[model samples]
Target chain A: MNVGLLDADVYGPSIPHLFGIKQKPDIADNNKINPILKAGVNLMSMGFLIDEGRPVIWRGPMLSKALFQMTYGVNWCFNDRELDILIIDTPPGTGDIHLTLATKYLIDGVIFVTTPQLLAVKDTIKSIEMFSELGIPIIGIVENMSYFLESTGLKKDVFGKNKTKLAELECLARIPLMESIAQAEYIDNSIFSLKDCFSELAFAVKTFIEN
Target chain B: MNVGLLDADVYGPSIPHLFGIKQKPDIADNNKINPILKAGVNLMSMGFLIDEGRPVIWRGPMLSKALFQMTYGVNWCFNDRELDILIIDTPPGTGDIHLTLATKYLIDGVIFVTTPQLLAVKDTIKSIEMFSELGIPIIGIVENMSYFLESTGLKKDVFGKNKTKLAELECLARIPLMESIAQAEYIDNSIFSLKDCFSELAFAVKTFIEN
Candidate 1:
């Protein structure tokens, strides 16, 4: 059965609730994840989530095993009958975990996450290089928490909007960021409902995975 | 609270069960864990047990996060009772996970797991160097599953027939493997007649953590 191996760290906000199953005792304590998904979709959140307070000092093997357990140990149910997708929420790094995930798992594609800032773009570029060497499909990049819109309705590109520049470095299908996903609620739940939608990105991921 | 992290991984087939805990799961499930000891003697199991089948592609961030969740998360009951000790099951290499455990956590001592086998010895040397670089105090290495003895009084050092040579590479406390370990019933329950008797190694670890 095809499955998704999600990675959750302190770097990002809680995953928006998806549907089908209720929250288990393992995740009951967290105020982050959403309650349930719609009828068809089911999400199984795995691995330790870093809270805002404590410092997380993890290296590699630990990270790799947890993900493996999440796949092998956790009871995962994929909606698609012939599902074969395992999308991992990898941290921004060319470190050990990233290397192992790319090399070990015959991953169909990678949806790299980053911000619109220069540093994030720079790191994402490095990420592309590392994965490219491993011959992993560079599906696209998700530019999260892009820019801040002041109360005065004036939008400032705090991180210097550089989506186009990033997509140039890699053949990215979609560059979703501040303008599209500036809100927190939408992201935490993986909701996609914008007038000028990034359906293109989501579709790209869907087509890439399904193909 | 004086608490020490014990490497739960150092399980011997002959050693009697200590503190009423099984060394490993009898019938292995996907989530195979080398039992965790509660507060008093927090012995953490180190190293991965591979099944003859699928590949064991551990040693990454997922692995590291699992260790953190196991160490810091979970019901790791420890209070400020003054420092006692924390010994981790270190992999036999300068792998990233080992390095993080050495540098990130409050590790007082380390016990290397090695076999008489040339391969194990080679990897153990690398492990020592990695630990040394992190500046963590290594109590000593323990030659594991060292030799095999038959009921007919025949002794074989099949694993590491060449002894002392491995010890010279890194001074260690040798633990010979007992043939009785082959008894499946004893192993399934792990109720060994002669429980863990590594007094010298225990003494070294205790001295390091308490001091």
Candidate 2:
């Protein structure tokens, strides 16, 4: 399956290093390899893409058009791989870019991700509602940065205390936050920082497609 | 009350050319003028903002900052005139500027204006949740352009046959679309157009703070 990985930021920051990894598999292949194709956003640079720590800032309409061009406009990834699964990582909030996709595309489903808190849930709910209004089925929600497992055998939800109750409202799969998630800065070749954070996501994506 | 009227797409050919009108206005003696405070969002001029429309075009953080400046930044006419009310015309959907005020300012209440039909009401509900979750009190919901009254004296819901049924979910009000509203646009001023279409809104804002 030809999977199109979208860099949903207004500006594209996740594509070049990803492509570099593909070019030099032996040198770049590591746990941080997301194994997804990176489609760039507007007003982007290749240097920033390879740096891995750059932040992208953007707003709507442009974002929508960027994603649209990436999805339908470009020839993305692999040799004649049937475009079966399209994974889109959305920019935070219910803005025009997301709305453009919601109104324009025939998306199969969306996976709403958020931190486990009333505020984060509020953002997720608004996003889910946008998708729902557009007739996009929400497969499920993901609660990111959920809890920290301590070496002393104690766990704590750093963002909030009422994550379970919040999860009940959105049926969110709780993903534990780990120091391992932010340590990729030391590895110059790593494309992404988090691996354990995404193993659950990969499982979810697999389960969602299967079920 | 000194109030600044703001809308992203504040004009089109639909706006009239009244004698007293120009592209922008500071104040009208009659308190009946509709200023193009939030100026052109025309396709070519999306990101372009003049000195006046600064608060509208800059997306994300700039949009938020501009909105705050517009709210508290601009010297409102009614500020010292026993400013009992401040009315802000927000853009549709949950984006940067909208969320900024909904979460930052001490907004009195929000009355989400939506069209009739299950689909329209769904968006209204999401908007309601956005404001509600931000600790902003939702005054109620207004179902604008709900039904079209035909010349044959028959009323029909253009969006759905039973949209009112869908609108009955919460504190909702149903308003039928009227043709006289169209006729009033011929008055050569967008302000008059507003007065024609939303006379009740004028009165509502006046009374909501008075007593």
Candidate 3:
């Protein structure tokens, strides 16, 4: 799919560790930073630029500059092939980074991922409102940690039921609390092991974009 | 104990909802903002100042100003009684707010709360490093969502085992995935119901400070 992933969550960049890539990206001949490729996906993260365990320690303006470099200064073209899509994993808040992205970039759509907790849902609603107010199209909501499956074939709502009703948006997928997904990064395994799990979500996003 | 809670998590202020507080803080006669008193605890949060569901939409400088106002411009004295200890609930990253708090305020210690996941632990370590570099003493680590107890009386490691060894810090407590704790906010109930659950942690913090 020629997919590219940008870890815009500068404070806690997980993509580098998730993909098990520690090598710093090399600058291309065109003066753009080259993204690390793993398992048919191009990835970039603040984790790749800095030493492990060191905090970014940057303010709003510095964060904006970093965001600009990631968005516009990175070489998304690998071997003369352009990227079909770029997925940006942002930090969980409606702060400066979000405002910068919303105002500067040409975002296709934003998919809100939240757990089945009232507190998380409340925060997600605020983000939805901020984006909606800025004229951004909301893709849908992906309810992660929806439930846990027991050996006795029972679905346990570990975090509780999704009682906080979202404002008329489509519920894309209810991803179960899978040990495989949780330990994927720690065990140095690719999340593509559960590709079938998100097939419906992929299709929904495709349909939304096409129409 | 006379305790005060300063919700320094300006991005997603959960204290207001967690404590079910909505009234704005009144301006005291001495030109300081009077912290809202609820259940014998003086509380202050960015959520109290803003309308429900509206995002703060502020940059770094604005956040610093708000934090300064909350910390210095608020009256921690209630009924002519001074606060014995003021606990600051910070956001989940080692960023501007954390830096500001560590540099500008007199912090006694920091307690890191993490789920039983490698990624979360990794992020927590970065915070630990930042605080340690800033000469702030770390109290200990509180592993939350450590396990879930089933009806059959089996403790399940829902996330995973705590394989990430923290450097020389005491493991304060391993709180289980309790439904009571998760739904406390939604039901508008005080978290004091689970006070017994956190008694050991409270004791650990008390002991650490005393020593």
Best by lDDT: 3
Worst 10 residues of 1 chain B by lDDT: B8-17
Q: Rank the candidates by DockQ, best first.
A: 3, 1, 2
For the candidates in turn, chain A alone yields TM-scores of: 0.66, 0.68, 0.93
What tens-digit string does per-residue lDDT give for candidate 3 at B22-73? 7888998899989998877899998888898888788888888999999889
- Misplaced by over 4 Å in model 1 are A1-5, A8-13, A16-22, A25-40, A47-59, A78-80, A150-153, A163-196, A209-211, B1-211
What digit string (tens of lDDT, one per residue) describes model 2 on residues B33-127? 22343332111111123332122212345566655544454444422333345556665555565666766778887777776545345445555
Superposed by TM-score, candidate 2 places the C-alpha of residue A146 at a distance from the truth, in angstroms, of 0.4
Interface RMSD of 3: 1.3
DockQ winner, 1 or 3: 3
Residue B202 lDDT in model 3?
85
Q: Please write out the lDDT profile of model 1 over residues A130-158, one tens digit for every residue.
A: 67777888776766545434334555453
Deviation from native of the Cα of residue B116 in model 1, angstroms: 54
Judge the docking of candidate 1 as incorrect, acceptable, medium or high.
incorrect
Residue-level lDDT tens digits of model 2 in A1-211: 4555655543333344334332321112222222333333221222233333222222444556666655555444333455566666655555555666677777777887776654455445555655666678777777775655554445655456554354344443566654443222222433244455566666766776788
> lDDT per prediction?
0.47, 0.49, 0.83
